[model samples]
Target chain A: MIEVINLRKSFNGQEILHGVNLKVNDGQSLALIGGSGRGKSVLLKHIIGLLKPDSGKILIDNEDISKLRGRKLKRLKERFGMVFQGGALFDSLTVFENIAFPLREKTRMRASQIRKTVSEELAEVGLSGAENKYPAEISGGMKKRVALARCLVMSPEIILFDEPTTGLDPLIGKAIHTMIRSCQKSYKFTSIMVTHEIPDIFSMVDRVAMLYNGVIHAEGTPEEIQTSKDPVIHQFIHGELEGPISIN
Target chain B: MIQILTLLRIIGAFVIFVIRETGRMGIFLAEAIFWIPFPPYLFGRVVRQINFIGVKTTLVILLTGTFTGMVLALQIYFTLSKFGAESRLGPIVALSLIKELGPVICALMVTGRAGSALAAEIGIMRITEQIDALDTMALNPYKYLIIPNLIAGVISLPLLNFIFVFVGVWGGYSVGVGIMGLSSGTYFGNIRDFVTGADILEGLYKSLSFGMLITWISCYKGYFTGYGAEGVSKSTTQAVVLSSVTILIWNYFLTSILVA
Candidate 1:
C-alpha cells in the first residue's frame, strides 16, 4: 500500500501542491487525471523520490519515503519503476540494451540469462525483432513499449507512468492502454498513471482521482468518477472549458 | 549616494551568487569523489570517455602544438640573433612549451572540444528526464555519468599534455635546426641542459588540475541545467567559456607557485 498525507510542494514561491492527501492499496491501479500543469507529474515525481515534497509524509508499504536517504532510499526505489513522458530511453543504447540495462547494472545474471530475459520482455511488449534498433530509429509508440519493457524487466512492485501516451495517435494510445492493462494483470504491480486520456483511461484503471487547484478534487471508482456531478469533475471529464475549474 | 548604494547592492548580490554556486560545486565534486571507490567500477565507460576526451582530441593538439612551436622558434630566433644570443633559442622554445604553453593550450582545446559536448549531452539528459530515470532505477547518476568523465579527464589531460610538449619540441627543432641553419646538436644540447625535472613536473601538475577543472565545471553546469533546448545551449556555452577562462587563470597560479 502507498499513502500520501498532506503532501505540499512549491517552486519559485508558488505552491503547486497544497497539503494534498491520497492513497492506493496494494495491487490496485489508480489513474491520476488533471488539467495541464496541475502538478500531476509533480505528484508522481514525489512518489518516486524524484522531487522531494516541501511538507508531507509519503509512506510506501508503511515506510516513510521522504525520511529515507542514501542507500536506504535507493533500496526502497529499487522496488519502483517509472515510465517517463518521453520514454526516457537511453539514447546511446539500442532497444535490447535499454531493456537489459537494469539487469546488467543491478543483477548478477549471466549474459545468456540476461539475453533470454530481455528477449522475453521484448516479446511481451510485442517488439520481438526490434532489439538492435536504437531509440531514435524507432517510432514514439515503439519507444514507449521499449520503456515499458525496461520498466517491467525489473519486476518492480510499483510502476509509475508519467503521461505515457501524451503524443501518440489515438490507435497507438489505445494500444498502449491495453498493453498496460494486460501487464497490470500479469505483473500485479501497484500502478499510478498520470494521464489525460479521459474516457479511454477509465476502463484500464480500477480507481480514478482528479486533481484540481492543488488538491484531489474527487476520488472514486472509474464508474463513480465518470458519473460524478461535481462541476469541476464534470467540466474536466467532459472537456468543457467554462466551469468551476478555470482554463488558466 | 543612492546610485552608489545601488551599485553596492548589485555587487553584493553577484558575490553571494558566486559564493553559493562555488559551495554547490564543491559539494558536487565531493559527492563525485565519494562514489569513486565503490563497486561496479565502470572501467569500460571510463575508457570510452578517455577515447572521446583524449584520443579524439589528439589531432587538434598536434596541429596547435606544432604551429605554436614553429612560431615561437621563428620569433625567438629573430629576437635572440639581434642580441647575438641566438644560442638561447632552443632553451627558450623548450622551456616555454614545456612549462607554460603545452598544458594551457591543450586544456583550452579540450574545453572547446570535449567539455562543451559533455555539458550539452548531460543537459539534454537532464531536460529529457534521463537523469531522473537513472535515479529511479537505483543507479547513481554520479557513478554512471559524472565519475567516468572525471576519471577520464584526470587520466587524459596529462597524457595529451605530454603529447603536445613532445610534438612542440620537434616542431621547434625543425625550425631551429632545419630552417634557421643552426646546429642540431646545439639546439638539442641547449634544451637538454636548460629544461629540468621540475619544469616537466610543473607541466604535469598543471595538466592534471586543468583536467579536473574542465570536467568539474562542465559536468556541474549540465547537471543543474534548467528546462528545454535553450537551457542546454546556455550550459554548453558556459561550460566552454568557463573552462577555458578557468584554465588560463588557474595556470597563472600554478605557474607562480611552481616557479617559486
Candidate 2:
C-alpha cells in the first residue's frame, strides 16, 4: 500500500502541490485523473521518492519513504517501476538492451540468463520481434509497449504510469490500456496511473480520483465517479470547457 | 544613487551565478569520483567512449596537426631567415608543437567535436527525462553516463596529443628539410639537440589536464541543461564555448606554472 498525507511541494516559491492526501490499498489500481499540469506527475514522482516533498509523509508499505536517502532510497526504488510519458527509452540502446538494463545493473544474473528473461518479458508485452529495434525505429505505440516491457522485466511490486497513452492514437491507446489491465491481472502489482483518457479507461481501472486545485477533489470506484453529480467532475468527464473548472 | 545600486545588483547577480555553477560542478565532480570504484563498473561503455572520443577523431586531429606544423615551420623559417639562421626552424617548430600547440589544438578540436556532441546527447536525454528514468531505476547517472566519458576523456586526449605531436613534427620535417632547402641533417640535429624528455612530458601533462577540463565542462553543461530543444541547443553552444575558453585560460596558467 502507498499513502501520501499532506504533501506540499513548490518550485521557486510557486507551490504546485498544496497539502494533498491520497491512499492506494495493496493490489489495487487507482487512476489519478486531472487537467493537464495540475501536479499529477509531481505527486506521482513524490510517491516514488523521485522528488522529496517540502512538508508531508509518503508511507510505502507503512514506512516513511519521504526522507529516505542513499542505498535506502535505492532499495525503495527497486520495488517500483515507472513508464514515463515519452517512453523515456534510452536513445542509445536497442530495445533488448533497454529492457535488459535493470537486470544487468541490479542483479547477479549472467548474460545468457538475462537474455532469456528479457525475451520472456518482451513476449509478455506483445513485442516479441522488436528486441533489436531502437526506440526511434519503432512507432510511438510500440515504444510505449517497449517501455512497458522494460518495466515488467523487473517484476516490480508497484508500477506508475505517467500519461502512457497521451501521444498515441485512440486505437493504440486502447490496446495499451488492454495490455496494462491484462498485465496487472496476471502480475497483481499495485498501479497508480496519471491519465486523461476519460470514459475510455474507466472500464479498465478499479478506482478513479480527480485531482483538482492541488488536491484530490473526488475519489471512488469508476461507476461512482461516472455517476458523480459534482460540477467539476461532470465538466471534466464530459469535456465541457465552460464550467466551474477554469484554466488559469 | 539608483544607477549605482543597479550596477551593484548586476554585479551581485553575476557573482551569485558563478558561485552557484561552481558549487554544482564541484558536487558533480565529487559524486563522479566517489562512484568510480563501485561495482557494476561499465567497462564496455568506457571502451566505447574511448573509441568514439579517440579513434573517430583521428582524421581531424591529423589534418589540423599537419597543417599547423607546416605553417609554423614556414613562418619560423622566414623569421630566422632574416637573421641568417633558418636552419634553427626544426627546434623552434618542434619545441612549440610539443610544448604548447599539440595539446591546446588537439583539446580545442575535441571540445568542438566530442564535447559538444556529448553535451547535446546528454542534454537531449535530460529534456526527454531519461536521467529521471535512470534515477527511478536505482541507477546513478554519474556512474552510468558521466564517469565513462570522464574516464574516456582522461585516456583519449593524451593519446591524441601524442599523435598530434608526431604528425606535426613530421609535417615540420617535410616542409623544412624537403621544400625549404634546409639540410635534413641540420634540421634533425637541431631537434635532437634542443627537445628534451621534459618537453614531451610537459605536452602529456597539458593534454591530460585539457582532456579533464573539456569533458568536465561539457558533461556538467549537459547534466544541468535546462528544458526543451532550445535548452539542449543552448547547453551545447555553451559547452563548446566554455570548454574552449576554459582550456585557453587554463593553458596559460598551466604553462606559466609548468615553465617555472
Candidate 3:
C-alpha cells in the first residue's frame, strides 16, 4: 500500500502539486487522470522516488520512502517499476540487454538463467524476435512494450505507468491496454497509471481519480467518475473545451 | 552610482554561478569516488571507452603530433642556421615535443573529439529520462555511467601522449635530418646528449592531469544538462570550451611549477 500526504512540488517558483493527498490500497489498479500537465506524472515520479516532493510524506508499505537515502533509497526503488512516457529505453542498449539490465545489476543469476528469464519476458510481451533491435530502430508502440518487458522483468511490487498509450494509434493502444490488463491480472502488482485515455482505459482500470488545481478533485469507480455532478469532472471526462477549465 | 551598482550585481551573479557549479561538480566527483570500489565494477565499459577515446583517436593524434613537430623543426632549423647552430635544432624540437606540445595538443584533440561526445551522449540520456530510469532500477547513474568513462580518460590520455611523443620525435627527425640537409649523426647525437628522462616525465604528468580534467568537465556538463536538444548542444559546447580553456590555463601553472 502507498499513502501520499500533502504532497507539494514547485518548479521555478511555480507550484504544480499543492497539498495533494492520495492513497492506493494493496493489489489495486488505480488510474490517475488529469488534463495535460496537471502534475499527474509528477505524482507518479514521486511515488517511485524519482522526484522528491518539496513537502509531503510518501509511505510505501508503511515506510517513509521520502526520507530514504542512498542504499535505503535504492532498496525502496527496487519495489517500483516505472514506464516513462517516452519508453526511456537505454538507446545504447539493445532490447534484450535493456530487459536484462536490472536483473544483471541486482542479482547474481548466471548467463543461462538471465537469457531464459529475458526470453520468457519477451514472449510474455509478445516481442520474442525483436530482442536484437535497438530502441531507435523499433516502432514507438514496440518500444513501449519493450519498456514494459524491462519493467516487468524485475517483478516489482509496485508499478507506475506515465501516459503509456499517449502516442499510439487506437489499435496499437488497445493492444497495449490488453497486454497491461493481462499482465496485471497475472502479476497482480499494485498499479498506478497516469493517463487521459477515455472510455478504453476507463474500462480497463478498476478505479479512476481526477486531479485538478494541484489536488485530486474526484475519486471513485469509473462509473462513479463518469456520473459525477461536478462540471469540471464532466467536462474533462467528456472532452469538452468549456466549463471550469480555461483554454487560456 | 547606478553603473557601479549594476557592475556589482553582475559580479555577484557570476560569483554565485561559479560557487553553485563548483559545489555540484564536487559532489558529483565525490559520488564517483565513493561508488568506484563497490561490486559490479564495469571493466567492459571502461575498455570500450578506452578503445573509443584512445585507439580510435590514434590517427588524429599522429597527424597533429607529426605536423606540429615538423613545423617546429623547420622553423627552428632556419633560426639556428642564422647562428651556424643548425645541430641545436634537434634538442630544441625534441625537448619542446616531449615536455609540452605532445601532451597539451594530444589532450586538446581528445577533448574536442571524445569529451564533447561524452557530454552530448550523457546529456541525451538525461533528456530522454534514461538517467531517471537508472535510478528507478536501483542503479547509481554515477557508478554505471561515469566511472568507466573517467577511468578510460585517465588511462587513455597518457598512452596517447606516449604515442604522440614517439611519432613527434620521429617527425622532427625526418624533417630535420632528412628534409633540411642537417647531418643525421649530429641530429641524433644532440638529442641523445641534451634530452633527459625528466622531459618525458613532464609530458606524462601533464597528460595525466589533462585527462582527469577533460573527463571531469565533460561528464559534469552532460550529467547536469538542462533539457531537450538545445540543452544537449549547449552542454556539449560548454564541456569542450571549458575543458580546453582549463587545460591551457592549468598547463601554464603546471609548467611553471614543474620547470621551476
Q: Write the per-residue lDDT of candidate 1 for residues B42-130, one digit (tens) a residue.
A: 99999999999999999999999999999999999999999999888889998999889999999999999999999999999999889
What are the per-residue Cα lDDT tens digits for candidate 3 across B94-170? 88988889889999999999999999999999999999999899888988789998899999999999888888878
Question: For residue B155, what is the lDDT in candidate 1?
Answer: 96
List fnat per candidate, in order.
0.88, 0.84, 0.94
For A14-111, candidate 3 gives per-residue lDDT tens digits of 99999888889988999999888889988988888878889989999888888889778888899899999999999989999999999988998999
The C-alpha RMSD of each candidate to the native structure, in angstroms, is 1.0, 1.5, 1.4
Per-model DockQ against the true two-chain complex? 0.91, 0.86, 0.90
Report the TM-score measured on chain A for model 1: 0.99
lDDT of 3 at B202: 92
Clashing pairs in 2: none
Per-residue lDDT value at B259 in model 1: 76
For model 2, what is the C-alpha lDDT against the true structure?
A: 0.92
Give the TM-score comparing model 2 with the true structure, all chains together. 0.97
- Relative to the unseen true structure, what is the C-alpha lDDT of residue B91 in candidate 3, on a scale of 0 to 100? 89
Per-candidate TM equals 0.99, 0.97, 0.97
